[model samples]
Every structure is written in C-alpha cells, then in structure tokens.
Target: MADPGLLGPQRRALILDLVKRSGAVRVADLVEQLGVSDMTIRRDLDALARAGEVEKIYGGAVASGARAEEPGFEAKTHLASGAKAALADAAAALVEPGSVVAVSAGTTAYAVASRLLQVRGLTVVTNSLPVADLLRDNVADVAGTGPTLLLTGGTPTPSAALVGPLADQAIRSLYVDLLIIGAHGVSERAGLTTPNLAEAQTNRALIAAARRVVAVADHSKWGVVGLSAFAALTEIDCFVTDDGLDAPARAALEESVGRLIVAGSAEDSAG
Candidate 1:
C-alpha cells in the first residue's frame, strides 16, 4: 500500500539501499536528492542504523561490513538473491542479437553470462573459467546454438578470473561491441576497484577493447573502494544496476556515465 517514490518511510528504504552499495555518503547529498529536510534525512539514516543495515559515520552512513570478505561462487551466489537476478537481467538485455561481448570474470559477470544465453549469434570472450564452463556446458542444452566462446588464458584467481600478461595480450588485439564488467567495489570518486592487480590490468584491457562498457553491479558495490582502480566511471558508457539504488548514487554514477539502466525498469533517465 506504499510507493517508495511517494512515501517517506519507503523513501528511507531506498536511501538505505543506496548507502549499502556505496560504502559511505555525505548528508548533504542525501538531503538534496531526497528533497527532504536535514532532519528527515537524518531520521532515515537513524532508522537504517538501528536496523543494522547501515552504520552512521561522522558525516554520513555506510552499509554494515557483513560481507567484505572475498566470497567464493557458492558464497556470493546466496548473498543478494533478487538483486543479482535483477542485475543479470539488466546486463543480459544489453547484449545484441549478433555481437561480440567480452564478459569479465566475477560473480556478477557469471550472472550476465547466464542470462546472455537467451541471445542468438553472440560471441562471448571471457576470462572466467566458470563463465566459459557455463557457456560451454549449456550451449547445446539452451538451444540458442553455440556462439564462439573465447576463454582468456592466464593465472587464475580464487574468484575464477584469468589474469596476467598473456590474458591481457590476448584481449588487446580483440574488439567487442559491449563489455559487461564486474567489480569488487565501485565508488564515484575512486571509480571501480578490486584487490587483484592482474585482474585490474585485465579489466583495463576489457575497457580498451570494447566499444561500450557497462558496469554490472547491485546496490552492494557503491561507495566501497578497493586496492586497485579498474576503470574510472567516466570510461563506462552505461551502468546496469538494481532499483534499490538511491537517487544520489544514481546521480553519482550518471555523472561518470551517459546512461543508467535500473534493473527491471524500462525507463532511461539522465542525471
């Protein structure tokens, strides 16, 4: 009986969701985006803090540090149930009918790869073993026919990515229409980040090869910055995310990107 777009309580839910993705946010930004008083925004933050969804910092709030540890496939698979599905859907729609799409290695990329099976005449180049495995194993069973799947060769990370000079070199010569990237953390100021240096270089290679870059992330990716910077948000053309994103987080991403696609929403709005 309540619309998040209209109700204050629902609005707080949206804000909390945004804060969760973004590690930290300033109070001023929330106030302006929510079109509410400082007190109202503070109350919203207070509620989220009480609920253990976010912890209040000096200037703003951030998500609880419950899952910062690098999780395995089985682990992250159960983490954000609906958000991952929604992110996958959004990432999948961006793939063209007949095109070369390079999928980066990560849990989010795996989701995108799984959804991309719906498309015909797709050549998927990826560095994730699980991604190739998913494509290789299901190409016939899915009935869409086999699109050329290129697996990058390199040293593998615990997260299942092939990251090294060999993989980077292979990615250099190739080109693709779209690149669906997965990130450990995404921040407006810090851009996209990860813990692995090789993976970061490979991500750079992916960014270089693709005509358009689309960052696939749920609300959990926002605000958090990692050791290595993958790509500046400005380098990306589009961002595919779930509807849980707050207006400020969307706006922050929009500043770096030209278009934003909210998962499950047909609407495309500018920042």
Candidate 2:
C-alpha cells in the first residue's frame, strides 16, 4: 500500500506511474494501492486524463497511447530528432526531380519537406500548413526554382494538419507520383494510425491519390496503436525508418512491407 499521508500530487504521480507501467489500472486496484478512497482515485484519474497523461476508460485508466492523446506539432518536433532526420533523408532519396509528390502532416513529414526543397521542378501537394510555409519561405534559396506547391484547404488540427471533407475532396481529384506520410503510431495489427478520425480519412485520400506511398517514421513509432487506422503495412510501397529499430521488429516489417529501408544502415532490406 502507498503511504496514507501522501499528498494529492504524489498520489496522482504514483497512479500515473502504475498505469504507465502496467498499461492500465482499475479504479479499485488504484484505491487499494494508493490507500485512498475510490472517489479520490477517480479524481486523480480525471486530472491525469485532462493533462493528457492517461486515458480514462470505464472503471479504470489506461496508458496514453496515440489513440488517447496527440501532442501538438511543436511539442513533437524535439523528440527523436536525429532519427527523424535520417528517415527524412532516406524518404527524400526516393523522389526524383520533376516528380509530383504529396507530403503528409507531422514533424517527420516536415523533415521530408525540408529535403524536397532541393529537388527541382516538382509539384507538391499537402495539407500541412507548416510544410506549405516551409516550402514557400525557403524553397527558392535551396533550388534555383521552386516546385509547384498546393495546400489543401480545411480545418486545422493541433498537429498543424488540415483535415476534413474538403481536404479529402482536393486530394481525390489529383494524383501524385509519391506520398510521403508520417504516422502517430505504427503496428502490424493497426498499421498506420492517428488519434484524429478526420486526419485518418484525409490520409486515406492522400494514399488514394498516390501511385506509390512511402511512410516515414522513427523506430519509436513501432508497436504503438492509435484510434484510427489509415493504411495497412502491405499498402505502403516502402517504409523508411531509423536504424534504432530492433532486429526482430525489422524482420517483422520486412516480412509485411514490400521494402524496408533502415536509414543510417549500410544496406537496405527488401521483403
């Protein structure tokens, strides 16, 4: 049992730690473990949920998966920086000059956009405001000429993505040679997923508009499941990720995906 004299913050911290470690915690269990009343435990869970630290479910709380909470775009920019850069570089390598490409919204996709500025005579379609701003502001400095850029108009998401019916409609009418997408979570079971349902639909539209789809995510994305699944593993033409992934996970991806490219590695692995 936890210390009976523990204050509110300390008790809540303990509850959060337990939920994170075990993936979930029943209210009854938490009350007993923390030596608190059921009502008190419930309050703690509510506070954690409001803070985006845990997801509350019937009778309990669960770890904050991508399905439970999505961090803001700026908040995610600092995470896995080197891995994201490597993944972006590898994803950029797949695009040729004069090719039309669609970029998705997310920090990793933003990295890919930075690299695409160097590729000349390209048409870029996207629903990410940051990506549009990045390309518009800096493309000319990197290349003598900038690629044709199109930004799909729609409602803005916390992750800086424009998603909804309007974004889907715009994407459906156009076709691109490639789509470089980022995922909130990646797992064999759930595939590419996002917490936002509209973003999932928008991502599906982006997939439909592309002849070839390449997904870029860091190793940390593996095995995380979000609320909505956008595409299955087999749907991607190529998956580019950092070398931080484990051998077993890499092997599993190789078996499921058409091609698995581990950035920073000496050689690429094909399925």
Candidate 3:
C-alpha cells in the first residue's frame, strides 16, 4: 500500500502510470495498493475517466483510446531492446555511404540512427527529435564534418515523433535514396501499422518521398494490429527483423516484401 497521507492527485497519477505500463489496472489491486476504500478508488478512476486519461472497464480502467495504448518513447525502449539493437545493426548495414536517407521516428529507428553515427558523407533526414540530437552529438569524421542531418518540424507525439501536416509538407519536396521505418505492429494481413494517426500520415509521406523503404521491427510486432495501417507489406524494399520471428511470418513477409533480413542469426538470412 502507498503512504496513507499521499495526495489524491498523486495517487491518480500513480494509477495512470501503472495502467499505461501494464495496459490495465484492476480496482481491487488499486484499492489494496493505495490503501484506500473501494469507493474512493472508483471515484479516482471516475475522475480520470472524465479527464479522458483512461477508459473505465468492468473491474478497472484501460488506456483511453486505441492509439493511446501506444507506448511512449521511454516505455518502448525497454521492450525487446536486444532484438531492436540487432535489427538496427542489420538495417544500418544496408545504408550505403553518401546516401540520402530518411529515418522514421520509433525506438527501433532511434537504434538505427545510433548505429549510423559513423556513416560519414551521408545526409540523414528524420522526424525524431532524439534521433537528430543523437546524430548531432556523436557524429564525427576525419574532416570533423559528419552527416548532414535534416529535421522535420511538427507537433510532437508521445513517441517523440514530429508528426503533422508540417512533417508531411517538409518531406514532399525532398527525395531520399532510402527510408527506414519502424512500426507499432506488423502482420501479413494488416501490414505495417501504427497506433498514432498523425504518425501514420507522416509515415505515408516518408514512403512517398523515398526510392526504397526498409522496415525495422522486432519479432514481437508480428500479428499485433495497431489503430492505423500506414504501409502494406509489399511497399517495403527490405524488412529487417530479429531471428526470433516465427517461420510462418517470415514466409509470408518473404513473399510480400522485396527482401527480408533476419538479425541475431548465424547469418543474415534472406527470406
């Protein structure tokens, strides 16, 4: 149980955090954890619901909206981190030096950007604030001039993505040799989906402005349909994913995508 003297707002905030992390929180558990009466906990949940922070269910509350279930930047970084790193490495290897590349905003895309720090004589465009900051800070070459980093301006989403009409407009006039995108979910049927509608709209622009599209995702993304489908599986030139992806998914993607690279395997197997 939490401290008896804890404030109401603080308790509600704690409950919100828990629900965001775990997807749902039971009223009974909240009552036990907060050391409050059932009625009090329900009142708190009701308040949160009224505020549109959460959706009230039978026994508890879930995330507010379908897209609201999308994990924030910090939360996603901890999920399948090792696999994401491997996928990023594989995806980065496909980027040729001196190429103009656009990297979408996601934890996996951030990982890919981290690996591209040493890719000299390149121009990288991105809609992710963290990705731009990472490249600006760590990039260095013999001439002390690193990649030309371009950032798209827009409203920031929960995933730290700059997504809106501004981002779309920024990408319209530009063309890139490659674009690496990460998804909230990927499946044979639903294709590449994302929880955020604005991000989805921005991603569509990225795809349109690129000659080649490489998608980076972990095995866990398979079969999880998000709120919006941004791109179909056939739109991807190369799909880089962890070796943990099941064979059936690999088979389907291999047929749909132009190429598939499995990271953390004995070899970079093509699907």
Writing each residue's lDDT as its tens digit, candidate 3 over 1-271 gives 7986789999999999987665556788888998998998999999999999988765677667633267689988889999998889889999999999999999999999888877777899999988998888876543555678999999999899999999999999899999999998887866897767789899999999999999999999887656567899999989999999998998899999988899998645454
Best by lDDT: 2
How close is every model to the real structure, measured as TM-score?
Answer: 0.73, 0.78, 0.74
Residue 17, candidate 3: alpha-carbon lDDT: 93
Query: Which candidate wins on TM-score?
Result: 2
Per-candidate alpha-carbon RMSD to the true structure: 12.0, 8.0, 10.8
Q: For candidate 2, lDDT tens digit of each residue in 47-99? A: 99999998886567667863457789999999999999998999999999999
Instruction: Candidate 3: list runs displaced more than 4 Å.
Output: 1-68, 140-145, 267-271
Clashing pairs in 1: 21-219, 21-222, 22-222, 22-223, 23-223
**lDDT for each candidate structure:** 0.80, 0.88, 0.86
Per-residue C-alpha lDDT of model 1 across residues 89-200, encoded as one tens digit per residue? 8778878889999999888888888988868889999999999999999888867666779998899887888999999999999999999998988888768877566788
Clashes of each: 5, 0, 0
The alpha-carbon lDDT assigned to residue 84 of candidate 2 equals 94
- The runs of at least 3 residues in candidate 1 whose Cα sits more than 4 Å from the true structure, single-residue gaps closed, are 1-68
Off by more than 4 A, model 2? 1-54, 57-67
Model 2's TM-score against the true structure: 0.78
